[model samples]
Target: MNKFEIFTNELLKWNKTHKLTNYNEDEIKKQIEDSLYPLEKIKDSKTAIDIGTGAGFPGLILAIAMPNTKWYLVEPLKKRYSFLNYIKTILNLKNVEVIRDRVEKANLPKVDLITSRAVMKTNDILKIIKPFLKKDSTILLYKGSNVLDELQDIDASIISRGNRNYLFIKGEKWAK
Candidate 1:
């Protein structure tokens, strides 16, 4: 099996014990596809962070796919943190690190990109990651059909990519 397949198998196995994912097998497959859609946009980024990385949707998968980019998977829960670290070791993923603290509490350096899925609304997410973003940093949010409505009030330029979207807003654009 490929690395993704192996990762999925392990995820499912862990799911049975920890209820890690809300997706079924088919849904999980689709989620993987959705998770990878932002790869092209984030390809040039030197550093990225996945906030609230529950079950490692785009973070772990992205780390596996892009070995050269440094990735930080921030998950506050102990169980999830342990699971991510376990997978990181199992896959021998050297590009990723697991942060066991909330985004606000973690002492993280500014990154080129920030990503999240099923975490929070667009505005809320933007607010949460603002302090950790640099001038040119990009935020990729994996959202559903309500993406348009979610971004309606936000000032950022939204670029649609399949089921995912990128919010291009500089630090100054953020409403304080």
Candidate 2:
């Protein structure tokens, strides 16, 4: 089994008791691969945040793929945090930190990119992360096929790359 496979199995064990993620083994693996595979555009990012990192879908996978980058995963639930901590410890991931807090409470440092999966609506997500974002920060959101409906209302330009839709909302605030 791959790292994500092992992680999914572990999560499944917890899910039976905690009801963490709704994805089965195949769905979980697909989500992990979808989350981690599209890094070419934002691969050079210095820091990243994954909001509502339920079972560490894109966040933990991103941390694993880009071990050199600083990664923050914000999850409010205590049980979820416990699972995340276990994964981190078992993987020996040094650049990842699981914050047991909601996204609303996240006073995140300026980061190059941010990602979310099954978190919130696209418009709401943009507004939620606005305060915590650097001027040039990009938002990578993973969504189902109907995401186009959500994007039609969003004012930002979007680049459809793989399973993710990347939005560079505004220019980077290199100084501010």
Question: Over 4 Å off in model 2, which ranges?
Answer: 152-176
Clash numbers, per candidate: 0, 1
Please give the lDDT score for candidate 2: 0.79
Model 1: per-residue Cα lDDT over 1-176, one tens digit each? 88888888888899889999867778888878877876776788889899988888888888888888899999999889999999999999998989999987888888888888778888888877877888777777777667778867666666676655655555546523
Q: How well is each residue in 36-132 modelled by candidate 2, as lDDT tens digits?
A: 7667767888898899888887889888888888999999989888899999998889999899998878777868788888788877887677766
Candidate 2 pairs with clashing backbones = 136-172
Find the candidate with the highest TM-score and give its number: 1
Q: Using alpha carbons, what is the TM-score of model 2?
A: 0.84
Task: Tell me each candidate's RMSD, in Å, in order.
Answer: 2.3, 2.9
